[model samples]
Target: MVRLPTVVIIGAGNLAYHLALNIHQSQVKLLQVYNRSRRGLSKIKKNTGVETSSSLNKLNRGADIYIIAVSDDAIRETASAITHLISKDAIIAHTSGSVSIDVLNNLRAELCYGAFYPLQSFKKERDIDLRKVPIFLSSHQPKTLKQLSVVAREISDKVVIIPDEERSKLHIPAVYVNNFVNHMYTIASDYCTKENLQIDHLYPLMKETLERIFDNNKPQDMQTGPAIRGDKATIRNHKKLLKDHPDQLPLYHYLTKAITRYYDENN
Candidate 1:
């Protein structure tokens, strides 16, 4: 039988919110929540009937694990404040994809410190069905890894052990897929507004783009559009229109040129 560890969560943002709810439904016992915001405290308290406080000293004692789910910048600072409160043997983990496991290294948690990154975008208003998301987990100690795996498995069916180095690599592509893609959408929205075109018209293509990837393993192989086909006339026409939108023109030209160069060099 897998032994479920007693856990405390140390944040109140979207990740922390859904994590607390997910852990509550698992075999692990949720001890308490610690956060700096009154609203964050009240939010989790309302959801799980769990005790919450802004003071680090007030953090629940005797817990087997602590998940620090604060923003990336505040993670180390928050971990510093609560290291003394937790049991020396208690596992300390964070849920960041970009930040490394070494951020918690200075606290001297050693074998007790690691990462529990969930590779999915979070929105507070949306309900999280963890079973559908991939969880990239890592730990410094073998026992700690086992304990965390059980907790993670209960929440996500797609849980996998990812080394810190590989997790870092995965984060690079993640930024392109989530952040950079969203910026592209914002640009498209701006262009639509200027052209008096309905942004809603792009919804089907946007949805299809995502659906294609979910149904395949390699997205680059599924690439489409004029640049891929070397349609010079269409490219020239697009660049002509781009002359009026200097900012977007540069970005569009840069991306299209890079893609064209890549195709020429490889294909």
Candidate 2:
């Protein structure tokens, strides 16, 4: 980070793919990219114009920073694989939200290890503005954390040094907001399809739901539903509508009951 860091991204999956593009756009020296196979490497090389390789043994040594952007489960193995290639003091890190930075340290005790997690789900086909994405960084060593902050600031204005415990806790709400919420969208889409309705009809509602968050509206305060209104007839109707669709019935009942509990307490 202090030296206008050079990067060698070690993975060709979605996170690595987008990271390469954004890092390339950041104007950092992306020295090389490596994957275990040639499958996704070609598209990355073609897109970012960075050299790509499939051999870990052939990974260029002495880069300022090596980004281990591989999958979470593969982190330990990947870090072990590159231990021999990097210098004793080389900076190496991963982009996993669930995995700890110590996983890298455990593999290569001589080198420096850190976390370079972007707190957003990445899709290769979809472009993201990294400037708006909050980047959480952590390292066992303060020096490494400082260096990571420097690199993170170069790519994103929103950077923070979050410890592993806090980072893990932070990912919980991320799941509620992103993963679980997306599943709710899936259910809504399926229900629409079952009812012979176009899912496009829900897009505006979806947009407004997100916009309300940015407008600083608390979801509880904005709540509007039969449960909140204590309209038993309307809630029973919704339950009846979904009863035939066994899979969605339970979810509908659960959410209604949960919302009702909130108002029940207030009353």
Candidate 3:
């Protein structure tokens, strides 16, 4: 972006942590990091060897790009506060999947606003493998789009230019595949504990399920097990077992109905 543009990140959470590391390693010149807390600022400063400040007013002046990797709810507020501190020509961006690019439209510099969304789960303690993850980029201005794309491609080999509307849809599927699936795992873990069963028993199935779909083709095409076999007895027993847990009952029935419907049509 702008031939190794000087960048500043305004957040100290998981997304910010990994993004700063990726940017620094790519020789993109991270000018500084901003956080309201001393502890968060210290962590980012220590990890990246980059300048950090707890005060937004003390931020480094005249950066080429300002990456606001803050929380979704605080995006607009933070952007508004920081916009006054940076140069008018400085391009501002946020790393959010769900927030539209127009969230920053009210800024004095509309042409310098954009979105840089990384499609993957992030944890504060865990280091993200940025090389494999795909980064989606969109900007209101064509020149800003080109600049952000160059910056994104430096840290990720799989960078795609997605339209704002399409990117919003992508976020929903991402929640289903990543966030919802992880919650399902947590539920399974609780079930395993209650039944004196090991969660390890499902590890192979879980891993293989993902590999098969990605390595092969559609999941509907690779259908198998009791549902595909039309084992009504097993299905009935599952619903019966889930009756005591009313919360899970609906999910069980919905998935079963979906599978049964698929088999009914495909067969």
Best by TM-score: 2
Candidate 2 collision pairs: none
TM-score: which is higher, 2 or 3? 2
lDDT of 2 by residue, 1-267 (tens): 446778889999998998888888886788899999997899999998999999876898978788899888998898888878887767888988878777876675558888999999898889888888999998888877877777788789899889887887888899999999999999988888888999998899899999998899998788886888889999888888877799988888888899989888876
lDDT of 3 by residue, 1-267 (tens): 246778888899889889988898896888888876775777777777999888877988778888999889999998888888778888889999999989999778354989999999998788888989999998868888887887888899999989987888899989999899999898888777876889998999998989988887788787787777889999899888777678788887787788888889877
How do the predictions measure up, each by TM-score?
Answer: 0.92, 0.93, 0.92
* Model 1 spans > 4 angstroms off: 1-3, 109-111
Error of 2 at 232 (Å): 2.1
Q: By the TM-score metric, which is better: model 1 or model 2?
A: 2
Alpha-carbon deviation at 224 in model 1, angstroms? 2.2
lDDT of 3: 0.86
CA deviation > 4 Å runs, candidate 3: 109-111, 265-267
Note the Cα lDDT for every prediction shown. Answer: 0.86, 0.86, 0.86
